[model samples]
Target chain A: MNRFLKILFFALLVKPMVLLGLGLNVFFKAKLPKQGPAIVVANHNSHLDTLVLMSLYPLSQIHKIRPVAAADYFLKNKLLAWFSLNIIGIIPMQRKHIRDTSALFAQCHRALDDGDILLLFPEGSRGKPEQLSDLKRGVHHLIKSRKTLKVVPVMMHGLGKALPKGEMIFVPFNCDVVVGDAIPFNADAKCYIDSVSNALNQLLALCMTRQSVVKDDLE
Target chain B: MFNIPIHSFYMMTFVVILLITGSLIRWRLQVKNPQTDYLELKQRIQSWWWMIGILFGILLAPTTVSIIFFALLSFLALKEFFSIMPTRQADRRILLWAYLAIPLQYYWVATNWYGMFLIFIPIYVFLFLPMRAVFIGETKGFIRSLGTIHWAVMLSVLCVSHIAYLLQLPVKNEQAGALGLVLFLIFITQFNDVCQYIWGKTLGKHKIIPKVSPKKTWEGFIGGVITVTLISGFVAPYLTPLTMVQGFVAGTLIAISGFVGDVVISSVKRDLAIKDSGTLIPGHGGLLDRIDSLIYTAPLFFHFLYYLHY
Candidate 1:
């Protein structure tokens, strides 16, 4: 039933709603790994961002991909909790438990161990749509603890315009989910958080420059 | 029973002429310019066939189906227009209302409620959407966001809904009927686009608006308008309630208004920094790209014909 609901909700309703409802055309500039146990990190902008990013994955991965959502927000009510946990397949992290990150750590490991793809916002929370803020330590520790995990930095623009962080109405704006090359974590990798942050910035800058080139060609 | 009317034959004749012109262009290109490629020209003609197919399909379908068809086009075009406009996230739910407006506006047309159809988007949607935005409690960029959303609905859904309404106009011309009015308006406006482009290419020198659309030229604009005005005079006697003079005026009206509509949408694409609205139609950028002129022309013609004849 959960699988059926996931297929119905994300694959059927949510996908078309975001793609057609929001008038978004999703393109993956970077090739995705056919099989993945990679930890995907992105800058959070809107609630639509998770759906937009998830849509980048092919339909076969509807079940394997999980977004790390705030447990308290999505899981506050029983029906929503069931919808989030079972239907959407989101891995909830209790943000209220400021110090105890281990529970989330265990859940992430368990999912990855089962060869499921995981998505996380390294910023810890949604920020101003355009600004990519300083990276939090949670992402660094997560990568460092698991040496074999590959960290893929994805940069999405226009989504901040599509549905801003604090806004409820999603203004239809075209968004791009740019995937970067998977950065494999090794024991002694220095400043991993800063590097991932820089990579995302680079990807975003590259997209902006490419967009200008398209405009120039139009001229 | 959906019987093909005399005006439907005229419409089919115009399409057939377009088909022959395409074949002639292909043949001429093959023989005369062996080294040059006519891919773009070929693609344009190819897209036309698809457009004609969908349009005539709807015209031949039951009235309910035709209404549904235009409503869907409005939905897609509005979706594309709003998708790129700078709307804030908190106001996302407001878009649901905007999308809802498409079917509702079209429903008014389907039921032939002329008074309600005319004012629904202009009045009700205008007032209702802001309330939705305000409910979200976000003040920043509120006016800008609200205006763009409302503007998109008005242009894409509301104005385009007038096209569907034209089909249901109470016309006394038995041979023509409302379908003729719909076809006359669409054919003249859309073909005006093609004529101007061709005329501009052949004898264009002066750029009308270089900054906005570099391709538009004085020669093309005049040539296309005169050509459409003449064609409208010829068709109106059979298809419309207008006399030859009125037909010429309507043609000129459509020509200028069509240009305004084209450039208006061009300005939008320019503002949004997009080349095309969407890629729904092959060779035709998006649905909006093909129908921009008609969006402005549809309602204008509907009102003009409604007052003059209906």
Candidate 2:
């Protein structure tokens, strides 16, 4: 029943609002992973980021696409927590002080193990709207032991200006989502994180230059 | 049920036939030149089907739906205008109020309140917007912000709303009613644009405005004016109250104003160093790009009919 409601929620509300309310220009959509056992990392801005990223996939595969959000923020109250968990289908990560790093992303690792795609925002928390912040290293830690996982870097622009943090009203702004080539899990932690950061930066540059993959390839 | 003029059906049929012809030409071109890609033309043709479908649906629906649809278009156009132009951080709230005015403006149209509709944007919005921005306490770029915001509302909302206002106009002919006028204006304007493009592509020479819109040429402009004027003269009596001569004059006005509107928008995009307004329509670039000619023609045709018929 919850799964049915999740699909219904996305199909009815989220998809239309994301498509119409905020016009999205997705580039190199072919690079997105069709199935799971992968991580889609993007720069976090507005709360709409998760929805926009999730709406990129077909509704049939929506159950497999899990977004990793902060437990404290999403699970702060009963209603939000229930909605986020059941409807949004987010895997909450505890952001508080943790002695063991493995326990923190255990839920994320389990999701990936279940052949589910994880949508991660490596910026830890939503930073200043429309500006990229430092990486929190949580994503790198999550993917360290998982060598087979493919990390796809995505850069989203204009959502922050549309509905940034603390703003209730949404200004209709055209958004751009650029997907980069998938990166295999690197053994070295520094190399892995650097590669993800570099991939994201390159995607950001694509948005800045307004360069999109050939329209024919979009098919 | 709401009334859709018989002429609208004929016009829609004509458009569909044109679309079929366009598709056939593309198919033939593909067969002749296998290496050359016709993706852009293909995308454009596909978009036209969707556009015409939505337009005819609205025309068939009740008057309130048409008003609401126009209001949505105004909102979307303003959103595109705001998106492309540089907006000041202080005037963000002011922009919201500008969006809010869309429904109110359309409400006036729905109620047939012409007196209020005419002055609400030009007088009230014109005076109130700058005052609203002043409350933000940011005096920087005051003139620039107010200028762009005011122009955005005027072009996107006030000008475009005239098309919706046509539905409210009292008409002499019951068969055509107001829908025919709406259909006539929109059809002629879009038709004029297509005529200009074809003329320009085939026999274009002597660039009209090389600095702003490089592709526009004198041959195309004159060819479009003559063709649209003649077509307008032929069809005006059937669709509108205008006689053959009046239709010819109206067509000439629309053809010239449509060119002006296209160039005006082209200049705005040129200033921003951008090609298109936004990516709302698939091949057309944006709603603004598709309706740039309508922006000018709507108001002019509305006023022209208002003075003569209404």
Q: What C-alpha lDDT does candidate 1 achieve relative to the native structure?
A: 0.78
Q: List the residue pairs that clash in candidate 2.
A: none
The best candidate by DockQ is 2
Which residue runs does candidate 2 get wrong by more than 4 Å? A184-195, A205-219, B1-4, B31-36
Model 1 CA deviation exceeding 4 Å by range: A28-34, A37-39, A70-81, A92-115, A129-131, A137-219, B13-51, B87-104, B123-150, B237-245, B278-283
Worst 10 contiguous positions by lDDT, candidate 2 chain B: B1-10
Alpha-carbon shift of residue A55 in model 1 (angstroms): 3.3
Query: Each candidate's fnat, in order?
Result: 0.14, 0.16
At residue B200, give the lDDT of candidate 1.
97
The window of 10 residues in a row where model 1 chain B has the poorest summed lDDT is B82-91
Task: Return the TM-score for each candidate structure.
Answer: 0.78, 0.91
RMSD for all candidates, in order, please: 5.8, 4.7
Model 2 per-residue lDDT tens digits across residues A49-143: 99999998999999999999989999999999999999989999888856688888788888988999999998987776667788867777887
Per-residue C-alpha lDDT of model 2 across residues B88-193, encoded as one tens digit per residue: 5456688889988999999999999999999999999999998998888778678877899899999999999999999888876566777888889999999999
Clashes of each: 13, 0
